[model samples]
Target: MMQFCYDDLDQWCHHCVHFVFVDEGLIAFSSFVLHLCAIKA
Candidate 1:
């Protein structure tokens, strides 16, 4: 039972890390797009 709990916690942490990585990528992409628009204007 304890092992199962630990496995679940590990999965959760992996998902949290993945989410943060994707979120950061999105923020960077949006900022880059905005920068391009600024340059065009």
Candidate 2:
């Protein structure tokens, strides 16, 4: 797994949210629908 030190999770999370969803519709919905940043995290 990719280990993020110095509490860099915030930036990584933001970057990930965009990279995964691309700020599109429906992605902001439930994980059962989009599964974005909600994969058992």
Candidate 3:
């Protein structure tokens, strides 16, 4: 339903520097969601 999120999902997924280092997909997903909230606010 969210084209914005779908489009940016990959970049958002990879943007989490800490998550990248730790290889934590869950953290990256959370980080991506938080980033979207911040951006939309």
Best-fitting candidate, scored by TM-score:
1
Supply the TM-score for candidate 3.
0.38
Put down candidate 1 lDDT per residue, 1-41, tens digits, no spaces: 22442355343343322332356656665455445445655
Top-scoring candidate (lDDT):
3
Off by over 4 Å in 1: 1-24
lDDT of each: 0.44, 0.42, 0.54
Off by over 4 Å in 2: 1-7, 22-41
Cα-based TM-score, every candidate: 0.39, 0.21, 0.38
Report the C-alpha lDDT of model 2 over 1-41, residue by residue, as the tens digit: 22441246454444434443554663654233334235536
Q: What is the lDDT of residue 10 in candidate 1?
A: 47
Which of the two, 1 or 3, has more TM-score? 1
lDDT of 1 at 11: 38
Instruction: Between candidates 2 and 3, name the one with more favorable lDDT.
Output: 3
lDDT of 3: 0.54
Query: Which one wins by TM-score: 1 or 2?
Result: 1
